[model samples]
Target: MESAIPAHLTVERTRPARKSTSFRPPYPSFSARFDPSVRQVVMAYFGVQHRSATPPPVVSEALAHLASVGGGVNRERAQYVDEAGYHTTVEIRYWTDPAEFSSWLADNDFWTAWPAVPDAGFFLEVVRPTVPRFETLFSNDRLEGVAVAADGLSGEIQEHGYWGGARDRIPLAQNDLLAPIGDVSARTVGDLVTVVPNGNLCLIRSGQEWTETAGDERQMYLTEVEPVLRAGMDFLRDDGLSVGCYANRYLRVLAADGGVTDKSFGLSWWRGLEDLETWSESHPTHVAIFRAALKYLSTMGPAARLRLYHEVTVVEPDQTRFEYVGCHPRTGLLRALG
Candidate 1:
């Protein structure tokens, strides 16, 4: 059976890039916006410690509970998950104001419940970066406890399961997928990932589904899984892929506690268009994933196909979220501080 790219470090944490820091390639004729086009954007990165005996499902259920209560984060997307070695990553995204968001963080009841979570005793980073675009293209930076190629493509993304939701936090199953690869600081973090900052141009495509009960097995041609497959084959292969990301039913909890289907977004590292392009074509494993994506699509019948739902963002803030965030890398993940 396939496991996460072999763990380079015995621990889950890693150090910042030691090789060399270069701007991720830049988007051609592109621009950068401080904030997404939506009301606001906030993300949290979590690294769940991987244990030889512990099951990943245990971690998944713990996150599922946090996302349901208004405890973890309050936003559009409910939750997320990514894999590296024995670690798992979680992120949340949504529409809200800073003050209200801060209030949610301050609530003591939330963190109290965090410890009981699977791998809860691990490390995490609470950060808010300058969202260069609406559809976030992510890249991982080497830091703290990790030792891997400074360049992206350290290994293949385990591409574990994902969960997310929007509008109402409804537990929508089968619409989530995670596409994670090794540390992606290679080539460029500045260029290809942030090509468009157009709020009007970006759109949130959701509700693409194929239900088993639908009974039309022959109707498998029309499905959301197509874009997901395309994302790996065409998008990741051809587009500026600085950092790879995964999907989740809900990365955050909501006030209403209602959600549906999983969602996706970017991380702090991905940038630079040129570096992204170079890795896509040169990376051996990436090429392999693309070639195999077609076969993977075959496993998911029309009902198991992907859904079409995404959010288009527009920059409304003159200043960026970095103003409020203090991030320092301890493990492979960034640790957020005041």
Candidate 2:
């Protein structure tokens, strides 16, 4: 495919080109385009925790409750085992309008009832990032998480296939470095704990899907690329504080029957956008993952069946609410302050 860089976006031509910067993907890519009138987008995670492989009744109950409310433009379900080996079933939903999200939360009481169920851990993490504070990139046109709430996909975007593409895509990055401000703090009310975020808290949901690959391609991705990806995610989740990352969860997208699927994502919280970019550009773990991915893409060429995508959002303090009920202190964003 011919490269079609958007005229509105510019690159620093004088900078030295790395392999990623020099190589252009054979496949066309796209980004989500939000409506100009829409000011903010909300990404909410409703999760229920369990120790056993089988989810407790409240997990399904929470899922059913979300289904009944049915407010967001997009919703997805995933599960992850935390550092302590606790399993959490999560449903993530996205909304473009803050008013609609507020109404939905009010109607559902934000899963306040889940705490009453004995021994069940629950959490509600909602981030309302203004349109400019977030960015999206997809290897293919298939829409996923937050992107589904977008007005539409762009026509072959240019701000990809490069290291700083994510930051370049974010409008705020044009004028601001998007540094961390203040500090994350938590307040406890009985069994519930609410974490108040600082300014410019960065959140990223980076996903991969290999469902379309078969034979050699599938084997290659599973054996070569995924291991590196998992290692990088594990690094961020386990030893990322030296950098600005607060916490990371490598979550698996679960099937309806509670089986793990071919999909997975790394959900992480960072101090700011600059911190994330620094890690992506300089971290050895990430560099290995990037090289493996580039090799896979170049080798597979057009036939590569793996789909990659990510959505990043930097939320203001006022635009966030992270509440955990009957949950471990390390649950979700709470670990940032804990």
Candidate 3:
């Protein structure tokens, strides 16, 4: 099928030159789900490296298959390469029952097939929010991001200052409830429970316009901004900071025709709001990157083909829940509260 995406913006998928080991399931159990009304959601990141500016057939096929299955996923969106050179796609699935999602994952062919394909990479993070545990703010009336992905997640559309003002609205608790379910506290290869700081889970979704036309602005984003953002994620994942930060992912929005757009998203799991603030404000790496990005966007203005914005949702322990099935031992919230 011909893609509606213009030739300049079209990104063909590419496979790795060589093969690698298959993704082995890390978690002891794969079947876990909260009540359907609670809006259990999963963000699955699937991608492949770009070779010669075109994506491999497998990459596109895998994405289509994922979207086709539905798997209780009410909505789906995708993007090609954002700043990250990898041709990545993300699917936000809402399952009425957690088990249904688990069953789909267990039987999905892409789970086994994609990894076998040379140079393909995939990871899934499932988030289930309890009532009154989470909050969302949007700038536009359009239903986008996680709000569009699930029911009962919509919020009032507000302009820029809303994020700053949101802090006061978020309810505070004197104690943190995110502790390991069992007694173990050290990083053991197969240990189920691990100790992590008390805090809430925060999800930030923000980005801007994506034009089919490409130029210097697109080039700069891919070359400059992408790397810096990637480095910050890497630091959080590998360093094992004083506060809890389970995982972080960057995704591009994919159109209906399987073409990628300019809009990008950052999905991260944090120990709490304070830790997230520390990284955003005090962390040298993050601070420098923010400064650079500001300058870049300011210079490009309307020509940049990108508009960046963000909304944050922080869920307290009782208000948030997570489940894993067929996942690695330390994946999602399970890593901290095994």
Candidate 4:
């Protein structure tokens, strides 16, 4: 099929008409519905890296400090080996309001407590987006990631199962270009480095869970769908700079014992919302992934047990933060600055 997007990018203040108005999901899917009173939400990723087989003392101490200061609506954990060959453990946390997050930080003096140059690697990445700037989609009734903090799941949303659906779900995209402005730059002082992010930076956390699958459904997802997904992720991680992707990390959700589980996600950063949308609609890598997923869902019909979901956001410059302590140059948003 030819791409629905134009070769040249254009900006409009009003929401553009969707090209796939007839599009509908083959199976039921839902989007997160936040409370009307809520104005903004925060998503923070706290990461620690080590060369050892297990987490070091600093990691335990950091976790304890985080527990004592508790303020997030929900939290989840994941692990991955970065390109630099270090074992990275990450804690993803969410908050429904920016004031609540600010109060938590101020009450705890969170900035002063941690060592500026920790013995182990550490980084903090934070994004605070208004309710309208972010969107979510889920393949199952069960909540995951940021959706865990939502008021409820929408009743079978119509904007999904096709390219550009993610853009359609975001309310701000209705009246803004969501175009990126400026560039990411870094400044270092001693062993600490702070990254200044661009305006309208985009972030996505797309996940998969197959724990409930059995029989033919299990084989199909593992053999057909997952391989294609991983390949697309790998391309974004390695060669995607030419396409506006800044960085990518394919992470494995970890169990209590730090063992790998049936869930995993590809966390990525993009230059802007338009860049991400263009790649998803026209890139061959994503095309293969979309086709493979559609085939799996079609073959299994309603009984398909595999679950997929994603949350995408375009954050303003003032609403973003990135800091690193004794970490490699390529860690997290540092790659963008690099």
What lDDT does each candidate get? Answer: 0.29, 0.81, 0.47, 0.80
Cα lDDT of model 3 by residue, 104-130, tens digit: 768873542453344444444445444
Per-candidate TM-scores read 0.35, 0.89, 0.53, 0.90
lDDT of 2 by residue, 1-338 (tens): 22222334334434322234346644678887776677888999888887667767776677677766767887788987888778777889888899998987787875746645555688888899887788888888788899887767777765567777777677666666678899999888888888988899999999999999999999999999999999999999888877889889899998867688899999998988878988998999999998998899889998888999899988899999888888776677777875
Sort the candidates on TM-score, descending order: 4, 2, 3, 1
Worst 10 residues of 2 by lDDT: 1-10
1 versus 4: better lDDT goes to = 4
Model 4 CA deviation exceeding 4 Å by range: 1-13, 20-23, 67-69, 109-113, 116-119
Candidate no. 3 TM-score: 0.53
State the displacement of the C-alpha of residue 6, model 1, in Å, after optimal TM-score superposition.
Answer: 42
Lowest lDDT block of 10, candidate 1 = 164-173
Residues 1-338, candidate 1, lDDT per residue (tens digit)?
11122232112223222112232222111111122233334444333444333446645665566566563332333233333223333434332344554676666223223333333333333333222223211122211010110122223122122211110111111121112222222111321111122111111221222222233332432343344433443333222223321111112222234443333322222222223323434555445443443344455433333322222222222222211011112222121110
C-alpha RMSD between model 3 and the true structure: 15.4
Output candidate 4 Cα RMSD. 4.9
